[model samples]
Target: MQALRDISGRAGTLLTAMVFVLLLTAFPATAADAGYKAKPEPSSGDFDARKVIVDHVLDSYYWHLFDIADRSYSIHLPVILIYEGRFYVFLSSRFDHGKADYKGFAVAKEGSRKGRAIRVLADGRTPDPDAATIYDFSITRNVLSIFIASGLLCLLFIKVGKSYRDADIYATPKGLPLFFEPLITFVRDQIAILAIGPEKYHRFMPYLLTAFFFIFFNNLLGLLPIFPGGSNVTGNISVTFVLAMFTFFTAHWYANKTYWKHMFNMPGVPLFLKFPIPILPVIEIAGAFIKPFTLMIRLFANMTAGHMVILSLTSLIFVLGSVSVFLGYSISPITVLFLVFINFLKILVSFLQAYIFTLFSAFFFGMAVPKDSH
Candidate 1:
């Protein structure tokens, strides 16, 4: 038992750390403004719900903490850019919340590059066509949120691991480990072992646990309405793509000869199907790629859709208020009720998505390894 606990602790810690490092290093940062500019109380009599939702959903250069008294408060992250082979590093605040140009680069307010840093013309208003190849590596909001989430996981497990390492062999688990141990076990037993088979489950537990908790944690964090929380890490297709690719590579890398044989040449199949058109084999090969693609799309779409629904509901208040203040006030209760229900549902979804992703990953891994290997 002691050895098992020790091994699990080290493995979890290592896997968590690796994820943390990967999140930090994987993507080049992008640009956006500080605080999300809240639409003023509809004084214009027109509310753009689409713009509001897009701003909230998309990644930004700074962390928007909150808005106050028509002023936006945000934590500006560092911006790294390479333009014309020259490296530039500075805080995102230099953009002045997308108001001013800094060092010949400004946040593009129009065109295809809207909301992104771009090289400016001499007048400093138009994008410089000559410097079109600027490479933006700034630390955007989603990237920073990923950093925070990964760091928290690392800290949480590190503390839990230390507790286990320092305690007596027979001591009862307590604190964070008390909460996490069962979860770790659930992934190992209920998901990994059940799907991948007991004999081969041990090797995949670290990855399964990592994927499960990473998705689960990010989902919960994205639901928060405050600083360091609202960034849509999981909703970003890029993040999901990377995650799916990891599973894709892992599955194919460890696939047995039988798995490939079944993919290319299934047993008992009619010769007509295999010989001339090769339709079945082509479909089987496509399924291998499709499996991971579905994983990516499932996570991205669910999280993104949840945020959009919630934002649209919230926007409804302003939309109604634009006509009459009383209408907005009247709708608040109903909107709030719906919001609460959806949020609760989303909480359930957060866990469910994580579980489903991990579950399917285990299934794929199991499919890759022939049953006879066990």
Candidate 2:
């Protein structure tokens, strides 16, 4: 977490531009038509789950390559990078969209085919698909966002670290760094102190602060209608899995000698039970790992599910509610209003989820630590 903040502060121009490319790759490609329909066209025409989710996550990243209003309903950002010689559509899903093969690429003439804009590439297409070839950057929309967000976070912390040592701490925070203090205080007092308890939480403030800010900012970003920030980065399973791993390790690292004995070599167990029926030890050990895993899944599933549900429900107008003049006026407003209401609820949920994950993690750590360590 500390590392993430450092990288954010150090994001130089080159890195920022790369981020621009990465983020733009998330935009949805515009289809052939700009009109709304009563029901969604089956993605099979050239779309699928992989594509929709990809587009949804990469809409901003691939915005120029393709557009939403122009395309029937593409949600994934398209790709473009110099390979061998021909140009290939990115995020098309391996071998499905005129790609080279399952290896996940294709070759075509350089330059824009129809109305497509070839951003930075010298030509629209590459001649050799396998020359400088790759598969969708070998990453999913979710993973890329996590990597970018992690990088941004690292930059933030690096700047903060330097500020603490170079600039006088007594003076007011200057520029953008000023935005961080109140948030840090809020996390320290409202979250860390409250969840981990004041007596033992001071040591964990750095972690708790980072977790809160990361989750909070990302959650807020996910609520937006456009850009890479809304791609459900926080909701990705792999990302969540990593978060669980962190929590699990933290619990273990903080576990004291007493906590270990309680789990494994517990006191007062009967000799027979200790040898063949070590029920308590097994249960304790399993529970230790299970707790963090559960925390991760719970958070990832809930946030992702909420967003999907809101989107699906609100999109009913285009799917089934009809495009009639009165029809839209009559229903779309209410649906949108409700979506906002639900989003407010989701905002609460994001905080609660993060708090729950952190609190449980702390509790698990305290449990794993020898009760008498303090």
Candidate 3:
């Protein structure tokens, strides 16, 4: 329409065209249940053949791969689990999976084929399944990936800060940070500025940044159906809950004296109302905690739902097979096609979830650190 042409400008027109093109090319996939699915049976020999991947591999249906699983320029493995199932599942997020996709954690399972020892564990020599895998869960790929990412982020910030400190020296976003332009801008302008206001964004940027990339990277890697590092990053509600708790604490950490004063001692209150109905203060306090709690659940559920939808669709391929391969084969492409689409959407959602989480966290932090008046 003329309205759309005027609205998007030149870039918008191109983007709109791309959207139409992609959508036109896009195949329709049946709507199915959402979240990762683990199979109770075996699958093809290749790791990709499984339903999903991560710190542990579990059988599930849905999801797909474009470049590779748990890849970050040959950095981390796909975090996942294999639960003796007949399907493979994954999530799409901002992952930095490595090209050298090796395996880890094939602990004696009915479906896994054992390989040579990678390292010695407390139990003794253990098979790596991938043969090249080392250290086992000693580093715990997910945790290690997080730790490494944290370190890398810190180093990057330090470099940026140092550049600022030494005005003569010029250093640009060299590595991972380089890839993040719109992401950082979106976080800063839309997320931090809009949510927390400019004055207070810096105080909370640490937690927000940590959570943003952590979730983003982990989510992307999780999309692949493999092992030792996959979408399980957020699927493990505990992980999300913990991240939420971090935001909870960050928000509460610098709660100004006036903020707490208002919480405990509201102005213009009646005597009797102040006693029981004063529960608003308690409720208000709980709301503070609940914010992040909801954040955790929201991200976890959304990401899981994306995975599960694909899993269910993929499961159709196998489930219908009893009738005939024609049914499964006929449906498989449809399922996979949609799975890929949703998988791609998941990457955006992963970034978005991280942004929303960070934005809200920043808002909470701004609430925590306040001026005497506002």
lDDT of each: 0.80, 0.55, 0.54
- Scored against the true structure, residue 38 in model 2 reaches a CA lDDT of 18
lDDT of 1 by residue, 1-374 (tens): 98798768767775685455334322111101111343333356676778878877887787776666767778898999998788999999998888888999999876777788999987778888778588888889898898999999999988988988899868656556766887899898889989999887877777889999999999978877665676778998989999999899888888888889888888777888888889889999999999999999999999999878877877787778767989988997887777776776777788899999999999999998877522
Question: Residue 13's C-alpha lDDT in candidate 1?
Answer: 72
lDDT tens digits by residue: candidate 3, 1-374: 97575444645545665465335323333222112222223253122213332213222221222222322222223334332331222221212121112232223323232221122233433433433333322223445545655676677667755655665434343333343544667777887777777777777665676688787766755554443234356755767899888888777777888778767776566656458667768877777778888888998787777666655555666666535768867887777877667766766776677777777777777777767744
lDDT of 1: 0.80
List residue ranges in candidate 1 displaced over 4 A.
Answer: 1-36, 40-45, 110-112, 129-131, 267-278
Model 1 Cα RMSD, 1 decimal: 7.7
Cα distance off (Å), candidate 1, residue 302: 0.2
- Among these predictions, the greatest lDDT belongs to 1
Model 3 regions more than 4 Å off? 1-178, 227-229
lDDT of 2: 0.55
Lowest summed lDDT across 10 adjacent residues in model 2 is found at: 29-38
TM-score of each: 0.84, 0.65, 0.60
lDDT of 3 at 81: 36
Q: Which is the better candidate, 1 or 2, if ranked by TM-score?
A: 1
Question: lDDT at 370 for candidate 3?
Answer: 69
